[model samples]
Target: MIKKRTRIVCVTLICSLLLPIQSASVKAADNNGSELSEEISSLADFEAVDELIEQRVDAMTDGDMSEYHELTEELEAHGCEDVSAQEVQELTGETSQGLLNSQIQSRNNISVQTKGLYSAAASNVTFSKSITNVSYGGKSYKVMKITASPKGRGTLFNTGSVTQKYNSSIKAGSLNLLKIVAKKAGSASNVIKLVSLYDTVCSVIRGFKSTTKVEGVEANYTWTVEEICSFIYVYDARVKNYRISASYNKAKYVVSMNLPYLKVKNGKSYSGITHKQYSDWISAQNYGKTDKAISCFKQGTTYNSWVYNVSMTGCKGKNIKNVYLQHPESAMTLGYWN
Candidate 1:
């Protein structure tokens, strides 16, 4: 009976020890679950901060000093000041960002035109570790702070408008519009007149062939600046009686061709010239006119260019044939005549 009683007591002791151990295990599990929940909550805070930072960056200017204050405040609030504006610029300009096999590029998911929060799972942006300086509205913000997680992840929020200032500096210039034209004559050898706005030739239209028919006559020719000028010089030589009336405006240059007392095959010889030949001649001359006009460009004109047009009537097909040449020069060079 004593042995039985001792065995019962030992069994009870064992049961009592096991009860405490089981309770301790349950408590540990509960603590672990709580920690996981806190981590999730921190992640939520991170996402909210990311959204807010993007909003202010899109609204600020990079060149303005005040922009930096806005960015710094945002960065401080979000925990991303590992680098500054100056640092970012310097790093970007580096030969290789001073790292072995490193690459830098804007995240594909990031919208270049708009600001938005980025989630780590969704974000594609990455950059090397570096220090940076930023000037905005007129001040610089130094290395404020840096944050890291036990995990190999980090976030940098430049809360100020200084980032925007940098962006604005990249967009400083403007564009202007221009037009050009060329004309040639009835006899292919006739002088090609280029009526243009400025004197300097920015560009030229070469190996151009335009065709048109006036009821029954056909005309064609290769058009270029050099050829057009050469045609004009030829016409001045062949027809001493020929006269040119030209004028220009800010937007257009017009040349009205009028050669009087010509020997028309018949007064009806106007029909023999054909509309196509006249149009071809006018087109050839317009290119030369454009070259000449380009030379007149002044300080403000340097950026502006020309739209040129050339037209003529009362010239014969014999005259047109002489004006059109197979190849006028080896390589067409504009402004060479000047």
Candidate 2:
């Protein structure tokens, strides 16, 4: 009787374990079925969207307004009401209106014959063109007449010209305009302004110096405009035979010669200077000199650490050199001075 009781108890325990295993298996099967249904639905949606896009492409290529409206209705019925013309073009490689305009500009066979180079001060420059046959929309179209004008920002020293390539077949005796404006490339004034700004900054750097210890030796030197512009400053303490390395904020325009100084300690340079610390140091300096330097140019502005906005008025003043001497300590500092 005890053996029979033991057997019944074992069977009950086994059934308890088996029940959970059976339940887990059923749950897993349910999850898999749900995933498969979602996947199938997603695929169906994709196929429907693709078909609608193709229909739109065909309609656009054929210029068929009726077919385009029919496709739009079908797309709306399929819950794709938010699909746009741009989206359809993106999916099907079909050309949008902007793309059509770009194609006309890039591929049109139109040549301009100017009497001479267009003058900046001239109100208008008349030119004639020989228009060749262009293949567009599977039809050969020839340009009949073109109306040209000035199109871009033109200063008294620089000018822009516009040329139109037209397809006369669209409307009989009327031009279907394909406008292409080309600007004359010249910045004689900007070059002059840049030269003047560079000369002023160099002169300022040449005159300024700070009495400070660099790499454990006293040095009477300050960072140059070029070094600051390059975003790194290096000077040698010739007496100590050690090199000093410090980085400055190039964007500040008038960077301070002091603060966050580094020295070569035991052949390794150490500094407590963070980027924010150096920037703050620069911010404390007087910008009067920098502002004066920039004012020497017509349209001079500081854009960032790397870009300086310098405009050209005209090259009239004598050119001055922006020179910096490479320190002898530069050779020992792993090519940092350059």
The model with the greatest lDDT is: 2
Give each model's whole-structure lDDT: 0.22, 0.23
Candidate 1 local lDDT, residue 325? 19
lDDT of 1 by residue, 1-338 (tens): 24633543455456446432121000001211221111111101222223333332323212343654564454443334333323322322212222111211332442422122212311222111211222333643111111111111112111111000010111111100012223323223333343211111112212111221111112223212111111111001122211111211111122222211111121221212211111122223233232332223211131111223222211121121111111111101110110
Regions more than 4 Å wrong, model 1: 1-44, 62-64, 84-338
Q: Please, what are the lDDT tens digits per residue for candidate 2 over residues 1-338?
A: 24633543465456446433121000001211221111111101222433353445345334687876676565444323432222222222222333334433654552321111212212321111111222334643221111111112221012112221221112111211111111111212112112121221223333211321123211111211111111111111122111112111111111111113233323333333322101111111221122222222213222112112221121122111222211111111111111
Best by TM-score: 1
* Candidate 2 pairs with clashing backbones: 189-312, 189-313, 190-311, 190-312
Please estimate how well model 2 matches the true structure, expressed as its whole-model Cα lDDT. 0.23
Roughly what TM-score does model 2 have, to 2 decimal places? 0.14
